[model samples]
Target: MKIRNLRLLPLLGLTSLISLNAAAVTVEHKPTDQIIIKFDNANVEGNSQARTLSTRLNKKLAFVRKTSQGSYVFRLPSRENFSSVKAYLKVLKAISGIKYAEADQMMFAINDLAVPPTEGIVGTKKPIYDLQWHYFEPVGGMNADGAWNQLDSSDSVVNVAVLDTGITAHPDLDANVIGGTDMITAQSISNDGDGRDADPSDPGDWVSRGECYLGSKASNSSWHGTHVSGTISAFTNNSAGVAGVGYNKINIVPVRILGKCGGYTSDIADAIVWAATGEDNPNKAQVINMSIGGAGSCNATYQQAIDTAVAAGTTIVVAAGNSDDDAGNYTPASCNNVISVASTNRAGGRAYYSNYGDVVDLAAPGGETSTGARNGVLSTLNEGTTVPAAPTYAYYQGTSMAAPHVAAVAGLLYVKKPSVTPTEVKTILTSTARAFPDSCVQCGSGILDAGAAIAALDGSVTPTEPAAPSNFTAIAGAGTVTLNWSDQSTNETGFYIEKRRKFSNQWGTYRSVVRAAADSTSYQDSVFGGTYQYRIRSQNSTGDSAWVVSGEVSVSRN
Candidate 1:
């Protein structure tokens, strides 16, 4: 394995900060009235299973199509009533031979405003270095400058797939971009007059007032894919507008999924599979950036797609979301086998609008334009209101901005260690992250330290016995006791949860009750009227840590 050459661009001008109000954009996402079902068997028997489920639920469910991940899409006879459709889903889930059933939820870009660039100095070609504080500031930046100095310069290019509104022709980014495809299946959403074509250029995602939903405000085209691609592979040391974290060694594969009023989960899922397995790709994408998402639990569609991609050795990185809520409430962010990134401000604190929770894998510089435009992440953009226009740069703020930073770093890691698995990449990234300089509760291990992550590829960062779980607690319920703890180790494969009943041995001898997956912070155990104490420890192939015990809690009712 070889490391790519990283050249740090010289800082030219004074830091120019612009204080601009972040746009108030309401990008609501909801189910598309279609249900996705996966049967135990997906052959002819699958159709039979669907028919049997329709008969059981007493609703006319029409087969729509098959998703790339092998899930079957079905449409109810009437879209007028969604309550009945949801009710049918409940019945469908209970039917045997059905693997899973869920509504095809919609997802949108997780970014806010896209304000045009502000003037830096009177006249100079280095406005970008002064404006892009999120990349080099010692307090809040990801320290890309330090990471660049550590690269070996003898490695091959790394491919990163950007799944978003698609890419536009930007002089700053086109050189590093490669062949890509549009994966949007809906004609209305594609907005380009066709569906699933070879062209991956963004056709603009602008929508009129109430176009997305009732009373929804009109929105301009975000050129989101362009911005994200710029963050990953913009030409470095070219005296260009802004510097990319990948140092121009990343080849972006744009897989367009989001369109007009956001995109469908089914489409995004298919895009993930395609981006991971497409044979036409010059090189397999080692890292995928999903800056687009919505409010929802991790459904089967996304889980299967993500699992498939990870199994194919692609490290997926997703935004934790911008709703300022727990990231566990979002889809791919909550989904297993991906790096979920939370947003941070220029002050190195949690951004005002970033999602936070145990699900988040780490934090990155997403930027907060509310403080100042210069504080926001600067990236390539198009100045068109509804279509492609003159190429430009802008300041944008959101988890959408943060994900590409991590993805770019992941690309660099892959360049250094070509054979590393997706899990290894995630572990290195989380373990190498530096502790947050400011308060950022539940923001995962720490803020992304690109220099540390890159340097970790030298085998200096070795895995050891994981630290003991912290904040262990037990709460008594009607007939069950819920055990909760915080994961403190980045390399742990899972958790060993042990519990002892008060009546059995005075809480003296504990037995392993459950072995939860890595990053699992909570578990529930049913009991028949007895007090119990719990303890948890992080486990890996290397070893396990000492147990962190919890107080006794009694479940009085059964």
Candidate 2:
């Protein structure tokens, strides 16, 4: 079952509802008390049969909850008894209502469970750098409804769990960051531990141990985790070095997975599970951002871990890789759950470095500077110094930077509408995006529309079902055909218009016009005249909107 992030408001006095102890406990060794069974849908006929089979299973084992659509929770007698459960499931398959079933393995928490600092005192300030050199720009989405104006009052604190290289304790991020653990070694991964007081020795960077033609050219301390964290929740609006997407209220839960070279797939999976629900952590985060990914097939271990995180009410936002190839090759991003984001340039076109496919959920502004591409984005960085002087701020380009924009927006949406599920948040962001030229088709759900998304929080313009485009009217004026028609009520962000000659029987090329809420119900088509056939389709946040056809509007050039 797919689970999206559900923002839950703070209860009046439930401050002590949960607590995480640092002392290691024998988690895996603990006797198994529950059994989670994931089944194949093809094995069962219908929901009625599934329910009947569930009842039969309950006769042999105590049932917990039907967590997802086809998954079930059961109380097991012991860990060793898991084999018996699997055997029974196989036997029951012949009983008409059963498919394959197996025992759910216990997963450890991936993060250190510790209470994060509450928003209050102002910390040391970092210095601001030149913006021209870097591509940093204020997020446009924050301008809607003056959301950024009330940065202090609104609970802008978002718990971003970074499953990447460990963050260095730089001056800019020191205050906002809590402690993290090293999943690779399964030991305390803090920069300073035991007697060692706050040592700034750990410079978090990617290193390649083996020799290759690429050599050490790629070997550089990116401080990637630190940079990504700052973008999402750096102490912004605080007269510091650089402003973050949000304000100072944001907190980061650092989960280190990537280190020298790329990290292991097993470690990544463990980190994701821990970050989302605090499965093994003492303190859990609300949102998890995965900026790193691999180009390979999806693994069963990772998929199961993702399922567990979603079941516990965590929203997983992943970056569409930088390969610039079909996104289907990427696993977790193409996985059933999680929100996959693509990169867009400032001109509102898809970045050449971004991966695209039917699986792409949405796109954001990933700055491009190498090829003279510009995308205005805002984020945080570390000033390498012990004394609080100027925090190192920079403008970075990558799907890495773009992912946080969506995460921050998600945080704001959570603050406004707490009931919205993760899936719903994905829906809102995708459906309400503003369509730019060469944008609708190349990018999944158009550009990220923070303003339109926030407007959706109050249910102003609700999304409708998908429908096809129909009917075409052509009005020739000023060397352009003014195309006008009634808007479709479902699955439409805008319309795609194409032109072709009647004799050739071949449709000329086409360009897309994003439908805006404020625009009148007409588009001026300037390129074509004489006899022509036109077709249009509706687009939504999920992908392309269905197409409705209007027979043909004959136009005579005046």
lDDT of every model, 2 decimals: 0.76, 0.51
Minimal lDDT window, size 10, model 2: 1-10
Report the number of the highest-lDDT candidate: 1
After aligning candidate 1 to the native by TM-score, how far in Å is the CA of 59 from where it should be?
6.2
The RMSD of every model to the true structure, in order and in angstroms, is: 18.2, 18.1
Show the lowest summed lDDT stretch of 10 residues, model 1: 1-10
lDDT tens readout by residue for model 1, 409-472? 9998888889988988999889988788899999999888877787677564435667988999
Clash-forming residue pairs, model 1 = 5-153, 18-373
Query: Mind giving the per-residue lDDT tens digits that candidate 2 earns over 435-549?
Result: 6545535567776765467667657553443465445566556456666667654334334444555546555543223222212355655443455555555434333455544
Q: Count the backbone clashes (under 3 Å) in each candidate.
A: 2, 35
| Per-residue lDDT value at 93 in model 2 | 53
